[model samples]
Target: MTIVLGFEGSANKIGVGIIQDGKVLSNPRRTYITPPGQGFMPSDTARHHRSCILDVLQEALEEAQIKPQDVNCVAYTKGPGMGAPLLSVAIVARTVSQLWKKPLLGVNHCIGHIEMGRLITGAENPTVLYVSGGNTQVISYSEHRYRIFGETIDIAVGNCLDRFARVLKISNDPSPGYNIEQMAKKGKKFVELPYTVKGMDVSFSGILSYIENSVEPNMLQEGQFSCLIDRLLLGGQETLFSMLVEITERAMAHCGSQEVLIVGGVGCNVRLQEMMAVMCKERGAKLFATDERFCIDNGAMIAQAGWEMFRSGQVTQLEDSWITQRYRTDEVEVTWRD
Candidate 1:
């Protein structure tokens, strides 16, 4: 029974977790919250992660009831995230590995989400819709790689939503996206926004720009604000998710797969899940999704993916371990999958 301790500070959230086999023992996370009108900057987010990581790590180990010496390996998210945050967590992970005399593994952030989803939901070979603040991709496993079937051409879905929330001066306490979701529920007026889908790829920058410029700032009447927010959320999500479902179905048709897995921060959206469910029901396919605990960025996913690599005889030397801000899902060689 091998145990892996994972660190994830891919973006605003700093996470620590312990995993054994395919099960998560403990997952603890903390997010950096700024003011209502401001967005999370990388430097500030990195500082937040650096300050809270040790506390998160200690709590994770205690919750798992394991000492650092009991850990067989230390894993950290290696890429496709903010540079400073990733570096902060990577340094801590390296120090832990050195102190504990355990091997280190560098896990791909996107693959971590996919592997964790599969482990939790038991979806063997499902088409994956990975959507987060920094990433948006339609992916599937083929020839030992998570091949990208479709992706975003510009800003990601979560980024667009969060940026819009910032324009509205919404509280970033829990999350800007969550506030948008809540505001969208009360929206009744349907305002048209640019829907850009070229082939398999989707673009959201135009939509965000349209919303920012066209929507008047002083239209905050009793029900007017809620109506506008709802319209934007419902309409924007409908357009975006439709493109996602279309591309995913096309990939499913090409691969002849009957299962779909939604894994990433945006995958926790109830409306997105509902749209996916309807699409899957029509195609007679299954849709697998985890709750916010795993869907949002967490260390358990990193631990799970790293453990898979570790079990497959993969290890990153201290000298070779590095972080990147632009690692793609297909760049990873999926050794554990057949």
Candidate 2:
């Protein structure tokens, strides 16, 4: 049984996971939350990760009941994330690898989410809808790569939501997005927002601008605060998720796949899942999505992807270990999958 320890601090969270021969042994993580109406700064997030990394790793090891020497390989997310946090985690990964004399593997963040989703849901060759604060892409396996059929042309879906939440001064304890989802449940009316879907690409900055400049101020002036905000939240989600379902269906049609797998942070939204379920039911397709624990960013996903790469004889040299902020999904050659 090959044992792999993985580190994932791509953004605001520090995660540590242990996996053995494709089975997850332990996955521990902690998120850095800012005050209401504030966003996470890259430097501060990196500092938070640095402070909690050792404790997170120790907890994961203890939970898995494995010694550092038992790990055959060390893995860390290498790209497509905030630079400061990524670098902070990579430093820890390198140190651990050097101390334990274990080989290192650089895991792509997006592929980790996709592979972990597939592993947990048992969905083979599904068209993937990956939506997060940092990324949004409709992908499918083809020609040894996860090809992107659709993606956000501007800001990501989760980012749009987070910024909108900040405008409303929502608490970021669990997550701004989660708080918005809860508030959206009370909405009954539908407010019109721009739904921009050009070709397979989506755009949310326009919608966000409209919300911040026109909608909120108008509602506040009209003295319909609670109802208008609820309407905006719910209606915005409905419209955005409709676009997601539409693009996902189009990608599925193009790929000839009946299974739709939802991954990444925003994939945990119950409303999105329900919308997707309806779409899949109508199209005679299957919808696959993991719970919040696996849907959001975590070390288990990185460990799962890294373990596969390690089995395929993939290793990252210390000199070649570098972080990237713009790593694409198709850039990684899926050698572990047939």
Candidate 3:
């Protein structure tokens, strides 16, 4: 029985989780939320994570009913995130590994999401659509690697949504994306927005720019253009989500995959899930997804990926346990998968 404690502070969220074998023992997290019309800076995000990481770690351990000595390894998200936040979590992970005298594994943030999604949804060898605040990619496993089939040429889908939310001066308390989702539900009309899908890849920056330019100064004034704002929010979401679905379907067709699994933070969006489900039904495929618990960034994903890597004899030497901000999904070898 292998027990792993994982740390994840990739972006605005800090989390700690424990996993034993294939089961998640506990997962606890804290988010660093910025005010409306603002996005979180790396330094500020790191500070928030540093202030609450220990408390979250304690909560995780207590909830999991485990001791330091009982854990066999310590794992953390090593990359593809903000520099300050990644480094903050890496430092904690390294310190704890040394203190516990256990092996350390640096898990890729993307793979962590994929592994956790698979574990929770029981989907085997499915084509994955990973969409989040920092990344957007359509991936499928091939020859010991998670190969990217399609990706965003500019900003990610979630980033696009979050930025639009800021333009609307919406609350970023729970999340800009969540607020946008709620606003979109009330929209009864769809205004035409830029739909940029180039072959297998999608681009969201153009759409964002179009919407931003369309939002005249007068729209910002209180109680003015309320109906237009609603249409833009809903239209923007539908347009962006349609682009995602198009690329995902193309990837699935190319790979001949019958199962589709959506991972990462933005995967929690009900509209995205529904759109994918419709596409899946048309293609005669299965759509597998998880709720916020596993869909959003959390430590349990890192723990789950670490468990797989550790079981496969992968470990990080102390001197080489460094973090990177641009780690690619295809860079890591999928040793645990056949």
TM-scores for every predicted model: 0.97, 0.97, 0.98
Which candidate, 2 or 3, would have the higher TM-score against the true structure?
3
Minimal lDDT window, size 10, model 3: 222-231
Q: Model 2 over residues 1-338: C-alpha lDDT tens digits?
A: 89999899998888999989878899999999999989999999999999999999999999999998899999999989999999999999999999999999999999999999999999999999999999999999998999999999989999999988887777998998888899898887788788889888898888888778754545555467677565568878888888898899999999889999999999999999999999999989999998889988999999999998999989999999999999999999999889
Q: What lDDT is reached at residue 72 by model 2?
A: 95
How does each model score on lDDT? 0.89, 0.91, 0.93
Model 3: lDDT of residue 291: 95
Residue range 134-221, candidate 1, lDDT tens digits? 9999998999999998899998988988987777787897998878777777767666678888888888888888778756767655
Give all candidate RMSDs, comma-separated.
1.2, 1.5, 0.9
Top candidate, metric TM-score: 3
lDDT per residue (tens digit) for residues 28-140 in model 3: 99999888999999999999999999999999999999899999999999999999999999999999999989999999999999999999999999999999999999999
lDDT leader: 3
Q: Candidates 2 and 3: which is better by lDDT? A: 3
- Model 1 misplacement above 4 A: 221-223
Candidate 2 residue 264 Cα shift, in angstroms, is 0.3
Sort by lDDT, best first.
3, 2, 1
Model 3 clash number: 0
Residue pairs with backbone atoms closer than 3 Å in model 1 (clashes): 184-230, 187-230
